[model samples]
Target: MFQPRQMTKLLIAASKDHIEEVIGELYKRRLFHIEDYVRNEQEEWSGYSIGTSLTQADQISSELVKIRSIINNLEINEEQLPKADYTKQSELSKKIASDLPDIAARIEAILLKRSGLEAEQKDLEQKIETLNPFLAFQHPLEILSGYETISFLAGYGKGTPVLPSESELFTSPVRRGEAFNIVAVRSGQLAECERILLDAQFQKVVIPQEKGLASAAVERYQQQITGLQSEIKAIDQEFETIKKQQQLFFVSSEELLTAEIEQAAAPLRFATTEHAFVIEGFVPTNEAVSLVTSLQKATGDKIEIQELEILDLNEEPPVEFQNSRYAQPTEALIDLYVRPKYTEIDPSLFMAILYPLMFGFILGDVAYGTILLVVSLAARGFVKGSEMGTKLIQILRNCSVSAILFGIAYSEFLGTSLPWHPIWLSRHINMGGSASHGVEYVSHVPELLILSIWVGLFHITLARILGAKNASVMEHGEHRSKLMFAHIGWILVMWGIIIAIWSYFPLLLMPDLTGLPLIAGISSSALFGGILILIGIVFIARDNVLELMELPTIISNVLSYTRLVAVGLSSVAIALVTNYIAITMIIDPALKNFTAISIILLIAGIIVFLLGHTLNTALGLLGGGLHPLRLHYVEFFTKFYRGGGKIYNPFGMIRKYTEAEK
Candidate 1:
């Protein structure tokens, strides 16, 4: 669809007595995009003010925080968790009151114990590392430091320092080539020991205070570390068991609490007086009547839902994409860039059409497309419950189909030509003679490059037309008319350049266009094209004289699409090289020889084949996806799209794990 869903403003006014019933009905329908009633944004009166949260808002929020902490501590992954059956709000609330506290306390206790053990294990390991240099020393650790009467330096030094006979010293080359020494003396001889060690360039290193033989201390720490590790491992296993048993409960409770808190806080967005409340929001035009009827039925006509005049909006209505199912997944792509303005065209439809088409055009290999198709299907389960991930997988599935269709036309299979000649174009029509490592080059690539340029021209022209329409709808009078003409000027400049090129260099990039009417005394299309360009400049000048500086941009934007062909050709070339090296150089030769060394070479070739194509496949997917996205965001959307519109998020949650009662 060209436009977002049509929306209408509504005023929901009701007695405070029916607030609960009215909010419930609204949530059930999930149609409204509520506007917050803040003093800064709305007219303030003596009695009218923002409503407070409903009863138990704090209690529900506190319970929800506990559930989230437990989930985080257990490392519960949403995708890996199984769904629970339909759970009523009453039932979930009861479970939260009865079961949540004990489970939270148990998990908290077990995790704290595990954390303590891990911390102890780390400390022991550090102590062992510090004592490693002294392991070979024929001395007890109790003699190392910790003495008030003794002064000592323990660290790396140049060599053993000469000290007073009353002082004691031990030195060893422990850290690479550096000497590690421990010098100790009675307090009376401390000054002499310090001077000698300082001359030796001693750099002190800290050591843990402990008692016993150095070897015995290290052995004791290692034992403690081993015991702590075992305890921690057991704790981890218990956690995994608890996660398995309680995942369904926690996941379901999280959703219910989250939704409950949302409803409890709904009043914060409403304006309330002494006994009445008013809620202002937008709903799809088609749903406005349904919403009113549904609320009346549920509240027994106690709640009032009126359709207000949709005029003089302080802010634009939230954009809800209205597109066919085939184009729906592309909405995620648009969201990554920016949501379209309600007044502008939704580019999802065009993106759904072109994004895959361009990707498929660039990666036209049947084997690679098939591989990608299988990958997307296999990965669907891994990324379950991720909406963006699912949408991306869906988009990839469509792109895979497109790639297969193009691959059929190109008659390519894993960088080699199929048995039959190309139905449309041969990416590998002429393989180059003997390349390095038995690799071959795809030389007949000019036609695809030329086709990419043509695609660019069409894509840019479409953008200009849409840009002009958007400018017309969003601007007024002189400004509107000027913008429309400027868009047309861009279109003309591109075509004029092509036509002029055709006159000067016939059949250079495109087909011959020699059958054009003559201009003035000359029979050259250049004269006619130059005239169009001059007139286009004048039309563009009416909008802004400075826009003429961007005239060359039309050429650059069109030229950018050439990546569609260039990236594909590079992929094709890699595939050919991979096949040639694996099959021709190693696989084929080894099969004939049939020896042990040949068998080893055969395995090596298989590795090369798999790894080379694996790398190429990743590169192809990246380039294929990013280049088209860039072209759309940078070249295509800049023409017509004025995004940054707020997304339509209704005041309700989509229950993924729970459902209605049967």
Candidate 2:
């Protein structure tokens, strides 16, 4: 419950011929986390290859690429497609070997034709646009291009340019919106003509290759474009139909092909020799026996599975946490910080208990709790079958339950007190005040602060106990005993200090001991507390003298829990102010008489009340959720947890698009 699952290293050796069988068995069982064999060039024994070469690996990889490309080109949305039918391995292989080639060839041909038509369409559109400017000129394209001696310039200018009479320049000026299309041809001294055109702000335009007027050329290009567009539309429709027919097949084939590629590449992780192969991996200790039996059976006793007796200090085993269903959701929170090392304890169970408890204490409101519970329940249904969503909903549900329990104790519904009596003294209740005005149980600052400190003390104490247990697991001999004693000393010192504070401080919750006899008797607790502190210091000094500096830190850590009370008080205050304004200024006055002004004020007050409460609830959730998590992560987890372990990743498939037959 407190620790991660134990792991054992398994060294597997088999003949080259049985390597495939061994790999298949291990993958099917999904029990082993393969450790890639690293070859040390300097060591002769490490230089040998341990696994047989995967000759089909490259072929499988190529097929996988092609399959992915086909799927991508089809733009298949797996969510919109129907689930694929389950097919045997042999059937799938044969279908892919025979049918895929033909399908791919046909699709490729269509795509190629579509690409050519698109290019042609684009070219025709460009040609038409280029020829549109010359439409005003009534001249053949051949005439415009054939003249070598007479240089002709056709382009748009800001206004018509003055033609040079001596050069026999023909000017065709046509207005086009804000600009004029000018076509001029001169016989000689073209440089002077060009300068005049440039002075008129003329920008040159290129003529198309068609040997006709610009209008005729545009008409011809448009007809071709229309034809090409029709062809492209037909090709797109064909693609759509093909996509609908083959999306499911492509999705299933991709999964199968990917799996095959992974299997073929498995040999790359093994160390191979001329006739034998060696594979090293970690498997759960509980399942090691069954996995070995299965592998032996699958390989016909050709493979040898040996559990290594010694673990290398440099190599850390992969961690797999085994937690109850209720505690599992807390793993997500734990992972957000760090994954526990294989040697460290799993804190999910502890977090499961503490996280919600603190959250409820911080957000103690019946109405908000009810709302959260409803929302969480609805979310659970909506996010069914999604692992992350389910975990989040579970956490919310637990927090909501805690909130409700605390709300009842606090006698709070939303930010106001309900008519029902509280099981315990409500935070709003003035414990020592008169009852004539009806005892108001507002969460007094001092009381809440004291409660928060005590909670913090208890939480930190538990953390230290767990940390001591974890230390005992990792240490040995005299060192383990010394660490354990130090942890005990710290625990004693914390309790002693708490006891001494209760006696010495004139706290609201504690009884007064002012007389000489009472003072003398209670002073012993302070003395006992001092003695415990000295004992703790003595024990921890052996580990490191610097650790003594942490004594003040314990006080600070306990004080940090005051955030719970501060946040809860803020929420209550906001709610109280909201209720006061709504009731005293608007709702109460309006209830006296239903005048127009009063009714208007009443409606406005209702709006203000709802908005204010909504904002307060949101803030409460944020503060309530985050501060509790901070307390656990920063103060609690740091005490015991040394995370950063690798997760176990086994070779197996959890098919969603397709299933295998039993």
Candidate 3:
């Protein structure tokens, strides 16, 4: 539970004739994480170079591309398709490869035709828009453009100009509500005509050379647009029907070709001589025997498998975590920081426990917790198939349960106390002349702060212990140095300081200190703590004197945990204020008598209550989730973890859209 699974290095050698069989068997077992071979002139294995698998790889890849193209063109939805059988995948790929060209060509031809029709349709629509404004003019469009002796300019202006009808240079000004469509003909003095039009803010309009009235041209274009649209719709319906018939085949063929490509390209990672090949990888210790047996059977005992001991310090093996379902969600949190090194301890189990515990302490309210729990459960159901989404839901669900448990202890429901008596203490008791039937939570703030500090102390101590254990494993059979003793001495010094402070400074935070033997206990604890500190300094001094600089940091880290209490107190205060305004200012006045004003106040009060509580709940989630994660990542991980290991990735496919043979 605390460590990643054990792994062993595997080296396999086989004749060229049997190499393919060996690769296939290893891939089927899905036990090995292959290591690419590196050639060194000084080593005996240097004579062998990477094997040639490119020819087979290219053929398989080509088939895969064709299948994917077909599937994309058909717009197949994977969710609605039936799963393909793995046993029949080879036959399916071969069949599609042989028969696909004819059907695909037909579909391509129709699509090309549709594309041309769509372009024609767009052009026709643009022509209709350009012609609609000129429909009122009953002249041929060609005549407007082809006059050589008379200069005819058609344009729009803001208003109709007061044309001198007797003038020779300009004629025919027509107006319609801030828009003027006018034609100016100049037999001479074209510059004066242009000046008159420019004064009215005219914008020129170009008329196309068509030998018909503007309305007749627009009608002709509209008819062509309707014909093209009908043709495009017919082609689209045909394409849809073809897709419905061929989508399953295309999807299955793609899957088959992809798997084949992966299998055929496996030899690229191996080293090969003229007649033999060698491959190296890591396999889980438990799977070693079974893998060897399967490979031996598949290759008819021609392949040799050897388990090699890891002897190089620079060669780190890949890491694979094995955690229970309850602890698995914490893996996502841990990954956000860094993966634990192969030899380092796995901290997911510890994270699963402490993260929610801290979050619950900060957000102790039964009503908010219940809402969080429901939301998380609904999210889990909605995202059931997504790994990260499910893990996030699980983390939220765990925190919600913790919050509810702590809320019961605090006797709080959405920041106010219930009428029923608390198992421990209620925050509302004995406030401003109210009867003191039970103990109040406000008076216990000091105790909660002390408890937060104590939690930090315990958490850091566990980190040190785990760190020591990892050090022992990494430095197995080595002689212990003074650094080892220094590490142990620090743990003792921390505990000693905690004890001495609790005994001697009880008056600072403890409400009831009459039972403590102050003089005797404080004296003995202070002496023991002093001795422990001196011993730690002596041991650490032999390794490096600079480590003494970090002694003050230990105290600061522990004090940082006090935010748990501070944040929780803030939440409680906000909730109390929300309730006070709703009850005293709105609800109480409304209940005095039934009137329109009272009813309006009652609705306003309910709205305020809901909005305030909703906002408080959102803040609670942010603070509760983030602070615990900060404590873990920054303070806790620094002690025991030094993560930079690569994750394990074995060969073989876990097919989502296909079923395996029995």
lDDT top scorer: 1
lDDT of 1 by residue, 381-413 (tens): 987778899999999999888888888888778
List ranges where model 1 is wrong by over 4 Å: 41-47, 107-158, 167-187, 198-241, 312-315, 429-447, 508-520, 524-527, 579-609, 658-662
Give the distance in Å from residue 446's predicted Cα in candidate 1 to where it truly belongs.
Answer: 4.7
Give the Cα-based TM-score of candidate 2 against the true structure. Answer: 0.84
Q: List RMSD in Å for every model shown.
A: 4.2, 4.9, 4.4
Model 3 lDDT, full chain set: 0.76
Q: lDDT per prediction? A: 0.84, 0.79, 0.76
* Residue lDDT tens for model 2, 426-446: 666332342212336544668
Query: In model 3, where is the ten-residue run with the lowest total lDDT?
Result: 429-438
Give the clash count for model 3: 0
TM-score of each: 0.85, 0.84, 0.85
Model 2, position 250: C-alpha lDDT score: 80
Structural RMSD, model 3: 4.4
Model 2, total clashes: 17
Deviation in angstroms for 417 in model 2?
2.7
